[model samples]
Each structure stands twice: as structure tokens, then as C-alpha cells.
Target: MLKSRPNAGRSQPKQQQQQQQQQNRQPQQQQQQQLVHTTSSHYGLEEFFDSSRNLGERQVKSGRAWRTDELRLKSNSDLHKLWFVLYKERNMLYTMKEAAATEYELFPSPERIDKVEESMANLENVVRERNNAYWQLEVSPCATGERPSIFRRDVFGRHRWHKCSQHIPPYHRNWHFRNTQGPGKTNETDWFFHKYREMKRKHYNYFRSRTARYLRDLFRRFPNADAEYIAELHPEFPQGYVQHLKENHVLYDDPPRAATRARIRPSEDVQQ
Candidate 1:
């Protein structure tokens, strides 16, 4: 009879059991559903619709990147929220820059805040895309449009531009005109033309004088050396001048030696 008595407080009451079941089921239901935007703070797009909404002014106050392992532990919903946070930060920074420029004041921390926000956005996008692709077995979506290019007309039919990594549409109305003043002046043909000719003339004269001096010195160095063989080695070289060196014994003598520089030799001595 004692054993048959119901064990006191062995199980929760029916009402309590129901409440616990509801709590567990609620989290499961949330996990099963896709997240939706509760606020359009990312692009500052929601500002136009609601005047009472307070968009925070731009401010830079943060430190360090979240560790990859920490980010990996976050749920998809949390990652989405972080993405919007960074997007909002970028919009705020842009707003501050425009306002500062309009007021002729320095944009405090200007590009720094924007760069930080952009880095976070990029990292988040990469992580999200990787997760999405892994889960769905599909490529991440990217913007599509006309390729980037410089517009220039050639002598032919109509044309469009293309570039290696362009993605924006080419609005012909907004095309930036390059070389508006047309072809530049040709100093290359006229100024450099005469300048280069003068340089070449000077160089030719210098080399010619140097070659003649070398031949004369060669004969003087070896007085009894064969002049014919010397002329044969330097066919374009002046031979008559070297003959004068041999006859004068200019550099051929040693020690108390020839004291004067030799003049340019006649061209007749040079072999054809």
C-alpha cells in the first residue's frame, strides 16, 4: 500500500510542462525561418520615409577586428545584422563628408572611418557569400552591366567600349570628354627634330677627331711597324696622317720624346 502512493514532485505539473514545451518550440521555429530586415538603416534609405527617425551622426570609435573563430560561431542572423551595421556606418561617414565640404570645414577622421567600415563590409560579404554558396550549392550573385572602357572613335562604324573589370552601365549622356582641346602641338617633330640633328653633327665630329688621333698614336708607338697592316685594320681610318707620324717620329721615340700634338692627317692615307 505504501509503495503504491504516488511519488511527490516526481514530474512537473501539466501547465508547467506546456510552458516549457512552448519555450523550446519557439527557438526551433525561429531557426527554421529566413531573416527579414526590421530596419533599413544600412543605406539611410529609411530616413526619407520617417522624419522622427534619428540617424546617428558619423563618429569613429572602435578597436580591433573580430576574430575569425568568433565570427564563425555567430548565427546567420547575427552576421546579417553586423553587415547592416557596417553599411550604416559607411552612409553616416559619407553624409558627414558632404556636410563638412558644404560648410568648408575639415571632415574629421574623413576617409579613415569609411575605410574601416568598408573593410568590415567586405569581410562580412565574403563570409556570408561563402556560407550561402556552401549551403545552397550556387554561385554568389554579382552586379552585371556594360564593361568599363575609355570611349574613343576610330575610322569605322558605331562602337562601344569594354574593359577588364567594368560593371557599371555607360550612360552616354554622362560620358567624360577627354582631349577636349584636340591634338597637342608637335614639339616632338620640330623642336626635337633640329635639336637631334645638331646633337648628331657634334657627335660625328668628336668621334672623327678621336679616330684620327688614335691612328697617329698607333704609328708613333711602333715606329718600324707595318703601316699597310695598320691601314688595313682601320679601312675607314686616315692613312696619310699616320704616315706623317712615322716620318716625324712623333710618339715613336721614347723618354725625352716628341713634345707637340699632331694635326689632323690627310684623308688620302685611309684605305677605302
Candidate 2:
């Protein structure tokens, strides 16, 4: 009973110390809580909207898209920032347009989306041009400097640009590279290539035949139309066929120009 009493006495002070430490921590936590600013978390979300335009505004005047020359003058870092800005603007516009559409209203200045898209395309082309120039100078030996790719027939027999990786000289003898790059010589591939060629041939013939039919109808309807100009549009027409059309037909209208002219008798000049 005496030993148990001393143990209990030690435990009571430890418990009191813990309670005091917790009491001290409570005020610090309370101070931190008090110091924290109570700003709304979504305060920055207004960025996705055009503040200048009212919800019911019929027209929102915006500037033209960034031209290629303008974008080329910008540094890479500027381009990077502009890309994000345009991206965000596009999103904002899309959201606003959707909101307006949901209410069955016309979105203000829909052409703004086109301007944004054009700017984005121009920006990408600028970046791509820069990349191509750098690669040509530093990394690639190919003309485009955009990693040399060969027209490879895939396993599906569709031609795809198969990008080649660079290596030390004498790449031809590298059997492993050759084997890995192309489609395997299998029965399926052989069959596919045959069918693929047939499909391509059919596609080519279909278009050419359609062009011929169109040319025939065009020549029938408007014989006075320039055969040379029509030939320029589709130069595949044989020279003989074009010359035949030029010589035989003059007009598809009711009467030929030669036949329509009223005769003016030469007797008037004789009398004078």
C-alpha cells in the first residue's frame, strides 16, 4: 500500500505538467488562428472572365490576333507567358459563351474565339520555326533539322513518318536498327499491303474519274469557258482532248455567235 501511494504521487505531478503544457499550447494555437487572414480562397477566379463586357453586351470589341512577325520578335520567355495568357483567355471566353448559350442568348463577339485560335496557331508556328532552326544548327543533319523521318508502311500498311534516331556514321550496316524500325515481314503484312495498295488505287481512280465527269459536264454547259483555264485547274486532261474541245465547241447557248450575227449588206458602202 505504501509503494503504491508514492507511485500515485509521481503520476499526479506528471498529469498536472501535461495539462499545463496543453493549456500553454491552446493560447498559441488561438493566436495563430487569430492571425490567419480570412480571405476567400476563390478571390482569383474572376480572371476567367472579360471584365469589360457586360453579361448582356451584344458586342465586345477586341484586338486582332498576334501576327507571325509580331510573335517572332518576342523572346521565348515572353512567348511562354503569352501562351498561358491566351490559353486562359480562351477558357474564359468559352465559359462565358457557354453561360450565355445556356440562357439561350447569343454570345458576344464570337469572332474573338477565332482571333484567339489564330494567335495560338501563329505562336505555335513561331516556336516550331525556332525549334527547327536550333535543331538544324545543333542536332540534326537532315534538311528540315526536324529529325529526319522516312515514309514507312506500318503493320496496317498505312504510310507513316517514322522518325530516325541519330547515331555515329555508317548507319546502313546496323542490322538491329533496320530490323527494329520497319514492320516485320509477315504473311499478314504482305496481305495488308496488297489490300492497302488496292484501296489506294481505287481511291485514286475514283477521284480522277469524278474529275473527268465534272470536266465533261462543265464543257457541255459552258463551251465558251476557257479550256486552257479549266486545263490549268486539272492539267491531267490530254492535250488532244483539250484541242478537240477548243476546235469543235464554241458555245452551249441557244445559237452560235457566228450564226446569230445579222447580215449587213455591203451595198451601203457602194452607194456612198
Q: How close is candidate 2 to the true structure, as a TM-score?
A: 0.56
lDDT values for all models: 0.58, 0.81
Cα lDDT for residue 109, model 2?
Answer: 94
C-alpha displacement of 231 in model 2, angstroms?
Answer: 0.9
What tens-digit string does per-residue lDDT give for candidate 1 at 8-83? 3444476688999999999888877646546535635644221222223344445555555666777778878887
Looking at model 1, report the run of 10 residues with the lowest lDDT sum. Answer: 48-57
lDDT of 2 by residue, 1-272 (tens): 98899999999999999999999999999999999978746747786787855667888889999999999999999999999999989999899889888899989899999999999999999999988888778877564655667987765656798877877755578777656655657788788888989988999889987776666666777767787877777776676666565555444224666798998878855966
User: What's each prediction's TM-score?
Assistant: 0.29, 0.56
The C-alpha stretches of model 1 lying farther than 4 A from their native spots are 1-60, 65-69, 132-272
Clashes of each: 4, 0
Alpha-carbon runs more than 4 Å astray in model 2: 1-56, 91-105, 132-144, 165-184, 236-272
Identify the candidate with maximal TM-score.
2
